[model samples]
Target: MVNSFISGLAGPLKPDLEMMAICKVSIPGLKTGKEQTSEVKRGRDPIFNQEFFFDHVTIEDLDTKNVSITAFHHGGAKLGKDLLIGEAVVPLREIRELNAKKEVKVIEEIKQAIPK
Candidate 1:
């Protein structure tokens, strides 16, 4: 079993000059593993304090699995389109290894481009 927590988010890159930014975190996996953070509203920096747990996740699965954190812009009622700001893909292999040694707890600060 793997326990994951999304403590918060910071520094959202706004795609549009006039849009308010909202952020969320998404991790894709089996029904039990899949989770996302609640949306943060109207700011360049947003904070989301959320937690997720993945039961029966093995080392092999960790090697192949990744946690995706994403930031999005919520358009108001007038403009019904949401825009993506950025995302980070964190591979779990290293985390798994560290945890195997002594139950490592890590908080990573990642900055990367959103996937197309």
Candidate 2:
């Protein structure tokens, strides 16, 4: 385990920076794949603009199975920007398995939307 490897290690032997993060969040559990607008003010000298769009997100990663996030906060307008702040990619196999388990199924199929 990672804990055992560094347990007795000294300062110089131990790496200064550890736990490289693959993802980030602006606030702990505030937003979810939505556009939120807030105000920005220039100090002292003052500038033209008063506000800008701040993107906040909550995640559901198939790659990460660390937590179960339920009772999610919902609804926000999508702005016309090409910035991808969060992701959700559910593989086909898992979706199929869920469908098989459930008595009544409701699944969104993206792949089937396109015609061959």
Candidate 3:
């Protein structure tokens, strides 16, 4: 099984911006898994005490899968589109090791997506 938890965001986020967090599990040879939090409006610090789960993950999949958590601004200066604020990627193998220690609070710095 795979699990994702989004706690909150803190930084220079615009106060009037509406935002949400998305959690996606990418497993090789499988469908992309996705889950999202509800919109938090008008706040620099958005709290999303949300958890997502994928039920069919096998032990072998841990070494080859990754979980991506992305934050997005909803309908702001970009007009009708959701703009990517930042994102973090974690390998499932690392998560499994942390889970064994019972300290799975893997903190990662969010990074801007490279222009493509």
Q: Indicate which candidate wins on lDDT.
A: 3
The lDDT of each candidate is: 0.53, 0.24, 0.54
lDDT of 2 at 76: 24
**Candidate 2 wrong stretches, greater than 4 Å:** 1-82, 96-101, 104-116
What tens digits encode model 2's per-residue C-alpha lDDT throughout 1-116? 00000111112323442211112112223234232222112122112122222232112322222221111112124433322223333332343333353221322243345476
| Residue 25 shift from truth in candidate 1, angstroms | 3.4
Candidate topping TM-score:
3
Q: Which lDDT tens digits does candidate 3 get at residues 1-116? A: 44555556646656665444333334435454545355566666676554455555544455677776677767556567776766788787876543553323322211123243
Find the 10 residues in a row with the least total lDDT in model 1. Answer: 103-112
Instruction: Using TM-score, rank the candidates from best to worst.
Output: 3, 1, 2
- List the RMSD of every prediction in angstroms: 10.9, 18.1, 11.5
In candidate 1 the C-alpha lDDT for residue 9 amounts to: 42
Residue pairs with colliding backbones in model 2 are: none
**Model 1 ranges with Cα > 4 A deviation:** 1-22, 29-31, 96-116
Prediction 1 global C-alpha lDDT = 0.53
Residue-level lDDT tens digits of model 1 in 1-116: 33343323434435554435554544467445655455655544555544445565554566677767666667678778877766777777644444654323321211123233
| Alpha carbon lDDT at 61, candidate 2 | 26
